[model samples]
Target: MITASLESARTVLSEVFGYDSFRGEQEAVVEHVVAGGDAVVLMPTGGGKSLCYQIPSIVRPGTGVVVSPLIALMADQVAALENLGVRAAYLNSTLTLDRVHEVERQFLDGELDVLYMAPERLVLPRTLDLLGRGSIALFAIDEAHCVSQWGHDFRSDYLGLHVLADRFPGVPRIALTATATRATHAELTERLSLQDARHFVASFDRPNIEYRIVPKDGPRAQLIDFITTEHPGHCGIVYCLSRRGVDQLAEALNARGIAALPYHAGLPQEVRAGNQARFLREDGLVMVATIAFGMGIDKPDVRFVAHVDLPRSVEGYYQETGRAGRDGLPSTAWMAYGLGDVVSQRRLIESGEGDEAFKRRSMSHLDAMLALCETVDCRRVQLLSYFGEDSGPCGNCDTCKNPPATWDATVEVQKLLSALIRLDRERDQRFGSGQVIDVLRGKAGDRSRASRHEELSVWGVGADLSEAQWRTVIRQALARSLVVSHGDYGVLVPGPAGGPVLRGEERVFLREDPAAKKAGRSRRGGPQGRAAAPIELEPADAALFEQLRSWRAEQAKEQGVPAYVVFNDATLYGVVEAKPASIGELGGISGVGQKKLDRYGEAVLGIVSGAGTSDAEAPDREPG
Candidate 1:
């Protein structure tokens, strides 16, 4: 029976989804669920996570109930599935009463292969009663990390999902998430009542993503340069810390001739929906948003995700960056962090209404994030270690490509601390980073002159160093907790770890920022940060790829779905490389499932046979 079920899974994978073989633990997950066992899956984004349950939903009897938190993405998910010829529908607030009745009718008649519902809707008595009247194949809980109150993006609705196990006696359950620490994983198991389910945790490493974090130096300008030089004319996302920041940055990028749009909860519903739709349907448009955007987006060609400010937690950072490179192509996870980000994040946590334990948890998360930014070691190593995964240096990240230098900044820190202490003791005053840096660099600005900072003994002491260098010192000091920014003004003060450094009892080492280098130059002579294509296509093949993309775009427009729903970029690349001349030959490619072959195979074969070195333009370059 197990062997036959596994064979059925393989058949579903090839015929419906158009993939030849399962990747990683996909086959194991499908087989377990198909055999009526539960599963808890921790696979990274773009790691083909949906297939684990999607394949089982097809091979198993009855409809699969998918409880999801992303109301906005349910339509897109169902649309993608429907394009593959699967019987999928979703129940959400966006549907009219008549449409809702039709969907419920489909579910009761066993017409839907898979059904998606928000957690709130799924937990209601009406919805539960409806499910009881139908034959359920399985229960798949997505974004299971939302159950962890300590984690970022917590949703109260997810806490009620434990009822699934109790209500649906023998129905198998699967909980999946792309980002989770050991703590979050434990909480997910406990909260979802999946203690006895099999656990499948994939590696957290995304080798195709080249991680690059830079100290904030004219951050907006820096971002512009990074986008233009590394990922021009590519689809990407830029995350900001505030709604105001999102709006301003989007305007700036548009002024600079980049097609950028803003998305946040603050926007009107229609505006946000419009911007999101355009981002999905159009190519090469940038979405500048806050943490409110991008939870379960299925767009497969996002080439880069840039952050102009420090994220509050490593888990949040990982989840956001995972949205890029979903096509398994080379992509970039780029961030620009500064001392202000540190102070602001700390202030927000301290000033929150949460109780003591909650405050402490938030602080711990921040400390880990700070360590990731300031580490002189490989960033990938530190990141994976946070998730309890071990890995060696990834040569693709910025640190591995160009390692930074470290030096003993103990004396420098002592000097900076002494100045802060003298000001509080002598003048009974405290100031923020700008004032303190001025005191260190001995810049006699108006505020410094008014405060008589130059009259102190430490005045002109750090004159030998530049303002930028001193700011770097302050940033490293804050990271190490040798100094802390406190109160609304974010005044610098001695931290718990500062006492030893003040007395010369302990030495401090800090990473020295490298000199700025020209953009668009790589270790090799190729263009910097460009994603390497899977196959180096000949000029004729490249033109053929472009033709295929044009055709796919037109299809997507007519169908009102994301282009990847018709066929992802990886599939197109495969088609061009293979130069399949017949329907049978095209069906042999990885993404060419039986449904797609039956639908578009003749059109594809025509493109291939007719694509004999016409002057079609080359496809846009891939970004890293």
Candidate 2:
């Protein structure tokens, strides 16, 4: 059992981790785990989930066994911990046999406080036998959602983790995941055998991330425009769907003088690792990679995450996009999607390996994601709602914050849906969107001639609309549930709601798609003439805030973490607003927990009280 006193724990936490107190339920989680209770933590990406287990591991009686999936993450965590003068090590494929044996000896000798390993390696019979001899303190399963079949990163080896608890029945266990829906959470608990575990869920909302989705047109140029304008000299990831696409895009960006690198499974393992390391170590390096990379990357200053192609599901998109803005400073999540993305993804699902039920579920997820991409409402509200969270219209995303003028497209929608139905009946529902679009515009392409579909009644009915406009109409039709993609034939079929509308018994309301604009141009007309800048704060207060920010950044850099993870903007704003003059006053400010106060309180309060005045004019500071 753990033997450390609360005072000792607090002292170590402040001295080692550079924080005065834990955030949110971190203190409670540490106490519970240290007392040998099982825990399941569902915290957001930047919510300090690691502290819950890390603190207990230090204070608890035996060495902590942390199961992590990514080698990069293990290295980063070990590096950060060692920077704090903590005894931590990770065993993975990257380690030499001698190093692994040495670490095992250290674990047996109770010299190492925390050790990280991949689940695949940890579940080995030899490894399990070795662990059986040690006094296991706690078993932490990081990225625990990988145990769920429904998760995007599901791994078969994760199913073997439950045997650890069976082997060490008395040891405390903590499972943590950065992203999990309600269903995923349920699956995680059951699969990990954490039936009696306490659940700690931090808020999933990311307020600092500004979300944006532009229709895919001239995508390469647009991507170049966006990266150059908004995120110049910043680290970022650009995701592509195919390895070939990754190489081509990386080369293209390089040709355009961007420091871009390509990463995918096709590359040699060492090459991939080198590119990934370069991306992490170098600023302004854009890594164009397939979905395989960046899963557990801990790079905090990533200014943006852009997707040139559509992700498979909303969960995948959300998790990928969440990598940005982790520093709590301004960051962007941008994606360029088109109808072709929907077609290609559906094709992949239909042709992939899975049972019928699984395929259908995958398709449903894709459909929901498509709806989200095309939604005209606040993107954040819709996204949060999918995760079973409620959020007000976030005035930070593209739609809610910058609504474009929309015109009624009911007539255009009716025309497009009608054209789809007429073509289906004429061609026996075998033609794809391209042929359907051609028939609708009365333009007879080679495929249309081969299929002889131009003789249909609706062939010339949509002649007034251009091809782009017609594509928008059909996309909206799918989004509105007036049409669905038939998996077997790869054709558009009228949905249940579309049947009545086709019979003229119901009217459909559709809004015009926003006109394509240059990347980063405000859709709500031009910028509301720049707002007047606020009057300057007293120079002393302004100078103090600047010094505080610089100090925070330096600390974060020294520890190799995102700056906000040390102290968020909200906390800094509190310091500026409240001007706490003492340790007690600093502790009372929001986010200034016990660990933080003890670590930096004296310095911060000194800066606050010393600003522009001698001790003569010092005012009594109030409680937060």
Indicate the worst ten consecutive residues by lDDT in candidate 2: 525-534
The segments of candidate 2 whose C-alpha lies over 4 angstroms from its true place after superposition are 1-8, 404-408, 427-429, 444-454, 486-490, 519-624
The C-alpha TM-scores of every prediction are 0.95, 0.83
Q: What lDDT does the true structure give each of the candidates?
A: 0.87, 0.77
Q: How many residue pairs clash in each candidate?
A: 2, 8
Q: Give the per-residue Cα lDDT of candidate 1 at 367.
A: 95
Best model number under lDDT: 1
Q: List the residue pairs that clash in candidate 2.
A: 19-595, 19-596, 20-594, 20-595, 20-596, 21-594, 21-595, 21-596
